[model samples]
Target chain A: MAKAKLEEIESPAMLEEFYRQMLFIRRFEEKCNVAYRLGKIGGYMHTYVGMEATAVGIHHAIKPTYDYMITAYRDHPQPLLLGTDPVKVMAEIMGRSDGMSRGKGGSMHVYDIERGFFGGWGIVGGHIPLGGGLAFASKYRNEDRVTICLLGDGAANQGVVFETMNMAALWDLPIIFCIENNEFAMGTRLEYHAADTELYKRGEPFGIKSERIDGMDVLSFHKDMQRIVDWTRENQKPYWVEIMNYRFLGHGAADNDRQLYRTKEEEDAAMKRDPIARLEEILLKRNVMTREKMEAIDEELTDQVEAIYEQADASPFPDASEVYDNVYTDMEPEKGH
Target chain B: MAAVEVATQTMSYRDAISKVLSEEIEANPDVFIMGEDIGRYQGTFRVTQGMFDKYGEKRIIDTPITEAGFTGIAIGAAMAGLRPVVEMMTMSFSILAMDQIINHAAKIHYMTGGQAKCPLVIRGPGGAAKQLSAQHTHCLEGWYAHAPGLKVVAPATAIDAYGMLRQAIRDDNPVIFTENPGLYTVMGEVPDDREFVVPFGKANILREGTDVSLVGYSRMTQINLAAAEKLAEQGVSAEVVDVRSLSPLDMTTINASVAKTHRAVVVYEDWKFGGFGGEIASRIAEESFDDLDAPVVRCGGLNVPTPYARNLELECIPDVDDVIAAVQKLG
Candidate 1:
């Protein structure tokens, strides 16, 4: 873990703000789990449990609506942090007419393109090249927008990842290939899936600037990510990053019995460095908020998340007639045989 | 068939496509063409021969031979507001990028709830040509037509090649624009007007008759025309219906033809068993059941991998003789 001493942003208000944002996401995802178990949500819903800092840290580094963002299935937090109404996101997960994709895309397909969040793509590593292409388009248009493409450690082994990295560097596009190395690829450990567990060095062979950074500490991670984002935008070139963290929950909502791959002891060890706890520790040290204030913030965010769940659950499903809507801009698909 | 007078020029299917491509690229600043060897090497079949010098790298991009990579990039580019025409050297190689096409490009618009669209055209030669063998020769338009989000068109003539390519490049949906290698050199009088796009899902009747109808698409449409000529010599009047678009299929025209003729023979260069011809054949039976006199006959290529030997390859493809025999089977 490369260390960066926190100096400038150690202000009380900034620390309190970080605490609230991270806690809000934590509460939001916990509610998603509850929603999935109650059958209110359908299909595969991969919740962002232990990897809070990576998404929040990256959000702090880039302009939410100007810089483009894309990620593989484990979505929701990007748009939520980018200012997509958590109710609308939860509605999408609930597969309602008010959902972002009008219920056409369930949990794995949330999209708010007007905000520059390209998607909630399901296929692992399939969206990497697409992320590069988004950068390619911005470059072609001579826009200085940076594209942040997030994928998992398991996705690093996909052939298209390397193929896209080569093109991004060769084409000199402004993009960041951020591999959220949660150390687990859907029950398969990093060592079991990758020939090299050190996934950050993926860009080295492609002449892309690359490194690994500690993701548990949100402030440090944001500082490094902001620097990388600035470098990519200024140079109009691609960079590779591996944000080291761990997911305390199973891969998806359907995933049960972590004993299939990992042990309870290993899980317990990873939990010690939980990003939210680490951020709280920094807040306490800096006297950002009293213990009672921290407790009050937790309750408020939890209530907010509960309201989001109720609102999403109350939303109506899309009409049967709308099943064909948006299949094409100019035409509808044949309805029936 | 024109309601208004129009100037025309005799040209090959390849040249017709090239001319229309140049016109579209010149008109739409958002439109650009990209693929492996499509720029400097002038494309594998010379379809983009002079386009490099004409359009330059800004609009005419040459990419590494990474189909999945570039195809995904093209889809992303399309989603971001650029209309990209990605040329595959052969539609056979598109199988390498099926995940990108089927999973990403085809699903983006629908999944995004109309937030983003892939105004993309993936065009290249399909079906068998000479001894291109099993790997290079594949009639994949049927495969793409099966996907819901895509619009599939396989034009059979130089005129149609020009019209549909223009329509595809300007379309707001992802279109599978397939050109049979055999149709490249086929000549026709293509319209010289920029606004001469022949809309999709509208089948053309090349020859009208009452005895029977020969329905087909791509090069098989030409074969059906030849079969109509052969059927005419044998005292049978065969209507030639060229089904240029397969996805938004012009079943109205096909059913109309079946009603008049009371018999039909579907010709396709793809495999006989479980091919796109079966879809059309089944649709005709379902649609024109009361108007028909006999069951619809399907004359598709032999159910085997296309062999490298020219003689064997020819045997695999459905020809005029095959169509004639298929029509005779209806009796």
Candidate 2:
């Protein structure tokens, strides 16, 4: 996958925006890690530390309301980029009342329905068909909206993914099946699971257009995703883009047995292609911003993230009386079942 | 209740359910049906016969033999504001899509804090039919009812089938509507009104009596009614309660009936152990313990997978004799 020229972006402002978004995600994930260690956040916290460029690039390329997005559990950065309030997202992670899902769904299931962010489903490959269904709705309603369904390389082997890919191709549903192939599914490496490691080619059997891209390069990711999104929107067809990336942190907050599966040397080598650093270098080479200015922006984002975390931490927990709420919309559930 | 002068028409259970689905599709453009053989072949049992010609292929979609895929798609469509009624070939096949039905469709609303509504209906025949062995014959209402966010409805009579299905279609939550293949050919009077809807969490007292309360749903409801008739002949008046909705269980009606009758026998087609019948028995023990004159007896299918042989299958499921025996033992 060759890198797309940065000149494709007409404005240096857009490049700076991309850099800022990646920086925000990196800083936000770091804070979530600290908060998790301090017991401020509960449940599983899957950070998006290393895959910032892929998250920022793909999300930035799509129409926020017109295009739908569904992903797996590693999903905090996607919602943040899609315009969910950072404070509310942090509150959700902290299990507070003012959270995005009112503290009902912790870090794994951030949902912003108004923004067309479907959810971060907990089950692997569970939302692939759901993505097809969303696309089906768009086609049925005579709308050209596209749905981008994201899954990990581990989820690529799920039978339902193939099932959905076939149906999406047969119906020509406007969807882009984006596989965030971060090499390992939790601690299990791709080689141990999949016979064919070429994740994007899995769609070939369904006759869907497929490709692999360099996920660490923000410009290449953004350009390819924009093309795929536009093609899907115009043609009402499904496509596949396997974003080759890596996760720097452990799979989840509790996955401390990383040394059992991977080596420190491999981790260091992968982090050398750090998406944030690459984007920062690109922005500097293009004279988008100076090193001091970038540092100032990072400091500002750091302070902003800290303030958001404090606000979330200060928010009240959901009232005990409200536990039964939202179980069903039209009926009052039996109390104390 | 005053006697209303509304005309009723007799129809098969299958037709009653199909009528409600067709009516929903006709009334709402967003409503559609998808399942294997539901479009052209008009369903395996002919429940959707002629629906393809009437509504065209777009509305009556015939999906590939992918239960998990189509089910998840239907949930997605429901989230996108389309009312999708997905038909599983049978309840047994729904196991393949359990992740979608249980994990996704059932929890999407609560997980999203009520921002997303999965207004989807997964309907199909359940329980043993003829000699369709262990793999095909599964009464899974108990499995589905155990989930909190799902609405489980098993209507026995033609009228209840028609009315409850209409309600399920209009409901803003995911509903698992299980019909009995054994009841599909059973003929009964259903209201001709298209707007008729049976509300959930409400049980109907099919026969009013004051001795023992016979509680059941789906095919077991029919058996309970038959048992009630037998008990009547034996001078033991038994009230038959059809628990149409399982998840939002009509415990109020069961409690009231048990309070009057003072004896209860919960009958179901599911196995005796860990079956939905146990839930009813426990509820009765908790709520109407003081009102009970005798221990709450449960009459359910044998603790075995349904056999292919007719006699063995017959012995496996609960019949009218089993219900009567259980009620008689409660004496």
Candidate 3:
């Protein structure tokens, strides 16, 4: 229950950028849904429509070049916010040759190592220890860098999470374990899956500093994350933050039976706390922008996104010969066997 | 077998492995070892004895009894440019960390489009030990070798253990270096040079012959060699081929020997059904079919779980007598 003074977002430029980035993620996911339905993109597609604040808030706090970031499969927004080209990400989703992973890894495995984003791991809670190791590397090399490992509420219950948390605390690794608690893990809610329901408290037994933050508010999330990032970098210790948020869409594009688990009324009530709309309200109340200017910015971004989608669509698919590439670094697999 | 004359020393397989690990840690600042009971208790099999005292706690870490956690942490560390050698206590315990080993460590480099390299080694004694029962013993090298992004090595001799382990630590890929508990006390002459690293994907011709080929790795290689010696006394010149590395299997040597002998018998301690020996047998049949005088015979462990009784245990895994019988059947 630690509190930071709730002040107006101090920088007008920063607030504007935050609003634009969240909107861009929202539109980007919407486009992804459309493309998935249109058969342009294949495989499992988990959109980050409602959890934009969580990815942007924490990522903005870390130095992208130095700090490391790793997350679960619902990961398109993270790479995009970390400065990965949207075109390449989109191409990856479409399984084209120009994709970030050269179409080898689809939506669930977007990685931009240059920007310090480790991966978009498919298994739940699988990357927790990896995140600790990334921090261990930085600490071992005496670098002033921290790693942020983001997992969903579902993954918070995995045994590896506790195992990794214990080791991270023991070694005093510089890393943050962020749980994006979007209420439900696929279809099971946090109440049914977690015994305590307080996800952040899981790290308490491991002696890691823990916090529960309101992830719906971008400014507050960003502020809290900046403090955690600073503390982690200076102390070289692990911290756990549970960002209480909600997913605005189904677990994946294929989860058409989402209505079976929850009702439309509940969904409507949750949407009322939409992060993008909340940011816009703050911007308007503080005279940072008028409604007309905000609408103009959205229009420009929408057109730009549309153009990017077209470019991604037009990009050529990987050649058939590429199926044998990137398997090993030293020897190539025998050809034409 | 290469002659080792200058500056050679007799050492147990366990001590030889420990020596190479010590050397690697001293040579590379980023190299470290971590596992359950590896620090104060030395190691489960004492393979890491004296490492903690020599390198201190920071470099020779002792982890909790959580395989998945430490293995993933090591993989993550490896990706971040450190070379980690993780001891699984027993390869049987490695099942708990299979997701981390097979999914994360093995796939990271290729899945990340070559941006990250997991230069880590997960090593420990595999195969059945005397009266260890079912759960403590497992020859799961075939399971590890099944993965595409991994290098699997099972060294039988003390020298192979020394040279291959050093090479595995330096390799850029994740390697599953399996050791046989049965071979730990077996003595062999290891090269005195600290930098004697044997290259991977090369099979060693332990004994040359012309009648038939006896192929195996790890403890089974020893069984094959013993059978070869007995077969030689019985007027059968058996060519013994030790397939040290199983993944990038030394098919060249296997094929060459099979072609010369015109017959082959693949051996392993794992169950016959879907064992790695099956892969070797299939490769010989498919690639060297034209050179074969008879069908490729395989002598592997029985399909039943390892038993605690000495009599049942002896019946489970292939021995020199079983290998000799298989070779005699081919004749």
Whole-model Cα lDDT of every candidate shown, in order: 0.91, 0.91, 0.90
* Model 3 lDDT on a 0 to 1 scale: 0.90
Each model's iRMS:
0.8, 0.7, 1.3
TM-score, cand. 2 vs. native = 0.98
Q: What are the runs in model 3 whose C-alpha is more than 4 Å off?
A: A1-9, A333-337, B1-6
Backbone clashes in model 2, listed as residue pairs: none
Tell me the tens digit of each residue's lDDT in model 2 across A1-337: 2234445563788888888999999999999999999999888889988999898888878888668989989889888988899999999888999998899999999999898999888998999999989999989999979998999999999999989998998888999999998999888999998999988888888889999999999887888888888888888999998999999999999999889889999999999999989888877887888999999999999999999999999999999887888888877666774
Candidate 1, superposed: residue stretches over 4 Å from native:
A1-10, B1-4
Q: In candidate 3, residue B63 scores what lDDT? A: 96
Per-residue lDDT over A211-265 for candidate 3, one digit per residue giving the tens place of the 0 to 100 score: 9999999998898898899899999999999999999999999999878778899
Model 3 DockQ, alpha carbons vs. true complex: 0.68
Misplaced by over 4 Å in model 2 are A1-8, B1-4
For candidate 1, give the lDDT of residue A51.
90
Q: Per-residue alpha-carbon lDDT of model 1 for B12-105, expressed as tens digits?
A: 9999999998999999888889898988999889999889998899899999889999999999889899999999999999998899999999
lDDT tens string, model 1, A64-175?
A: 8999999999898899999998888999999998899888898899989999999899889999989988998999999999999999999999989988998898889899
What would the TM-scores of all predictions be?
A: 0.98, 0.98, 0.97
